[model samples]
Target: MADVPALVLDFGGPVLLTPFEMAVREPEGVVRDLFLEQGPLATRQRPDPLWADLQEGRLSEREYWARKAQAWHEAGGSAPDVPVMFESLYSPPGPRMIRPQARALLADALAAGRRTAILTNDMRAFHTQDWIDGTEIIHTVDVMVDGSVEGVLKPDPELYRRLAQRLGVDFADMVFVDDQPHNIVGAEALGIPSVWLDVTDPDASFDRARTLMGLDEVVRDG
Candidate 1:
């Protein structure tokens, strides 16, 4: 095995551009505008008391998603469930959903014989089977541990431990990256080095991961 630190990445915001980002950049129609443009990204730009419930942990991620899915269905979206809703919102061109920087980082890391894994809370929950199978990053990674499949979510210490155990690496030798603060803390609590990805400034976060993993130059936007 390569002696370099193993890299663990969260799937949503860290690996794929979040649905919110996609929605804002690629507005499909009324459904996109209703559930996404008026939801998370909107909450990010302006304070919404309900969204605050999510930040403060009063609302579970599932609860928030359920609310959005329900609203979308009620607003005439064809997909009634989260998974279908997600596929509809995200659309085809699966590879394009991945951040370019993330793609570069994973390519270089794997090329260097580093072990990389995706630890996601919602890979299975929010995606169709075909989508997961077709996603290049999903196939490229050394391993993927999803909470929806494993019946646990991030910020839960057990999830972190399970990932380390599966990789057969100690927490000290792994670098974890996640966009959620709570998930980062969970990994760090176990002595894992982590980078909290700032979605607004993603390049900076990827730079920090590169430094921590002893990788070469950062991926610059061209």
Candidate 2:
């Protein structure tokens, strides 16, 4: 870990603490049903559509919301309500806390002078303001490379490469962590070592290169 020059973090599962499944559970199904009942044209230009564009850094939040509002009007859906929806999507059920050990590990890394950044494939509709309010974890990072702002999605080597470039570090010199296996594999293919974080376990034990509990062990081991 000390040898590594930079660390790349994933947002959804790591830094931006939220129970995404629950947050979108109700709205997602309803939205999908609406889309199914309607045509692609009616739904394709909506806020969620900005998801892809945001992932590719092709659309900004402001632009996405405006278009979405218009799309909703055209589709006869309720007028696009950005503030309400944004708050609903990004708001957490309760206070989201960082894993104490994980936080300690990150603080140590930063104290040791290592560079760190956030690289998440987040939704376009969700704003960073929600993240700022919801969690205290993000304050530890040096950079925030959100896919929604970058216009690139993970599992895409280009995104990893771009992040590395932005951090001014070589891919091999970085260690990335994410909860998704595919994302881990994708980073590995690019020569970036990665750890798969599983935050649900009570014991918090992780297999080699795969973390089920927290990143303390990985940081210590690396």
Candidate 3:
């Protein structure tokens, strides 16, 4: 098939380092210690039954974070809820929030004549308006479909269809990249090619996307 003419990216995992990765940077405190001791970071080293529960879909994303926030609050951490927890976790955001490959992929795709867009479920919900307005990827892309703003969430075919319409491309002409498997399945169900970003190895994930879009030569030559 011809190279997909447009690229759609999920904002959180694929573009930004996950909250698990950011937890290490959090100031030394009960919340940071708690996350490192019992959360996904710990799960990376050993089996965390709670992480397993999340992976098994027994806990929704909100519930998982809410549980953490509640635990942290009970432990004397400042954050008492999901939004507050995220704010504390992602403080002083700037270019550091973006993965380097995400910047290159977005720039290279646009340079190579592909429309680029971000389809995010939480940019607005989890981040402050000032942060959103100043984020590099928010301004770099040709289009941005924010689910929180639209009252829609991903893995919902309607959001995908809306992004395709906004990008002026058919589903088959776009390549969607996200770290979530369910989102990949949803895009693929509508004939949109997709890259499942491995949050553990984002470079490899971006390499897969660059290869799928045949962007290596274009970026190399330019």
lDDT of 2 by residue, 46-162 (tens): 434554574455775356556654554555544566544444444662333344434554665676577878887754445546555556567568877767668877878988988
Better of 1 and 3 by TM-score: 1
Residue 88 miss distance in model 3 (angstroms): 1.2
Candidate 3 wrongly placed segments (more than 4 Å):
1-3, 37-46
**Candidates ranked, most accurate by lDDT first:** 1, 3, 2
* Candidate 1 C-alpha lDDT tens digits along 88-176: 86767476788988888888788777899999999888988888887867888888899999998998988888888888888888899
RMSD of each: 2.9, 8.3, 2.5
Mind giving the per-residue lDDT tens digits that candidate 3 earns over 1-222? 234568789998888777666666777776466665354345655555776687677875657767877887888767677777767766667877788898889888988878889999878877888777777678988899988899988889999988988888888888889977778888999998899987667889889889877898787787
In model 2, where do residues sit more than 4 Å from their true spots? Answer: 1-5, 20-86, 89-97, 128-136, 202-222
Model 3 TM-score (2 dp): 0.88
Alpha carbon lDDT of each predicted model: 0.81, 0.58, 0.79
User: How displaced is residue 189 in candidate 1, in Å?
Assistant: 0.7
How many collisions per candidate?
Answer: 0, 8, 0
